[model samples]
Target chain A: AQSVTQLDSHVSVSEGTPVLLRCNYSSSYSPSLFWYVQHPNKGLQLLLKYTSAATLVKGINGFEAEFKKSETSFHLTKPSAHMSDAAEYFCVVSAFGGNRDDKIIFGKGTRLHILP
Target chain B: GAGVSQSPRYKVAKRGQDVALRCDPISGHVSLFWYQQALGQGPEFLTYFQNEAQLDKSGLPSDRFFAERPEGSVSTLKIQRTQQEDSAVYLCASSSPREWGQPQHFGDGTRLSIL
Candidate 1:
């Protein structure tokens, strides 16, 4: 079974400080990993994705994640936290190939808080 | 181009009532997905449709949950005998090719409340 675990349920960062949200995944095969953000009353927005091509992936709003196969981790990071960055973040993983029906497993989610 | 759109932005149903939520995928998107997102939780897959074919529905919690994409462009999810636990935001997303690593565009989602 493929599953994603977000290490923190909540993370608080001061504005302009660096931010890190950790995630680990379990998959039978090489997996496709993604990070998504959701604002209040808004839809989930794709941040970045890792598809075996590159270990380091950069995404919108200065967010990035590194795919570490040995560690079974794909952690999202940002150089500085913005007030608008306060939102719910999710780590998701899906199998590389086979069936289109294969569902993407998601982490519970991490709520980011930015303090000024 | 417009993004995915879900209608009945909000729906409130009583127990035993049947409710239908609709989704309009982006133009030319070949794959559409429906997910159930409970309050304070990540979206859980419910079903997938490739064009007009309903490929997978293993994530559906019960038979009471039914989804259809008859025309391949618009999809509808119907829940019969709504339960209190079913109250949550139902999200709709669509992707271009239905392949791994393809980015999915999402709609705001319909907030369903079961009484």
Candidate 2:
């Protein structure tokens, strides 16, 4: 079974400070990892994805995540926090090899709060 | 270009009533998916479609839940005999294919309330 675990349910940070949302995944096969952000009453937006091509993946809105196979982690990070960055972040994992029906498992999500 | 779109941004239905949710995937998208998201939780896969074929419905909660993509472009998810537990945000997503690294584009989602 493929699954993702988000370490923090909620994180609060001050503007201009660095941000980190930890995520760990479990999969029997090589996995594809992704980070998505959702604002209140809005659908999820892709932030970044790792497909084994690169370990450090950059995404929209100055966000990025590093895929660490040894650690079984794909933690999202940003150099500095912004008020606009306050939203719920989800870490997702999917199997690389399977039918098109392969399921994507999502983490519980981490709510980010930015204090100005 | 427009992204994946879902109709009826909000739906309120009485228990035992039936409702249908629609989704319009991006042009030329080969894969479509439906997910249910409860309050304070991540989206859970409900079904998947590859073109016009209903490839997977493993995540659907019960037989009352049915999904179809007859044209391969537009899909509908129907729920019968709605229960209070059925209340949640239904999300629709589409991707070009199941190829590794492909990101699924999601719609704003339909917030369903069972009264």
User: In lDDT terms, which candidate is top?
Assistant: 2
Tens-digit lDDT string for candidate 2 (B1-115): 9998999999999999999999999999999999999999999999999999988899999999999999899999999999999999999999996666788999999999999
**Model 1 lDDT tens row, B34-57:** 999999999999999999998999
Give one digit per residue, the lDDT tens place, for model 1 in A1-116: 78899999999999999999999999887889999999998899999999889899999999999999989999999999999999999999988665533578889999999999
Question: Candidate 1 falls in which docking quality class?
Answer: medium
lDDT for residue A69 in candidate 1, whole number 0-100: 91
User: What DockQ do the predictions score, one after another?
Assistant: 0.80, 0.88
How far residue A41's Cα lies from its native spot in candidate 1, in Å, is 1.1
In model 1, where do residues sit more than 4 Å from their true spots? none
Chain B, TM-score, each prediction? 0.97, 0.97
lDDT by residue (tens digit), candidate 2, A72-107: 999999999999999999999988665632679889
Q: Tell the DockQ for candidate 1.
A: 0.80
Q: Where in model 2 is the C-alpha error above 4 Å?
A: A99-101
lDDT of each: 0.93, 0.94
Clashes of each: 0, 0
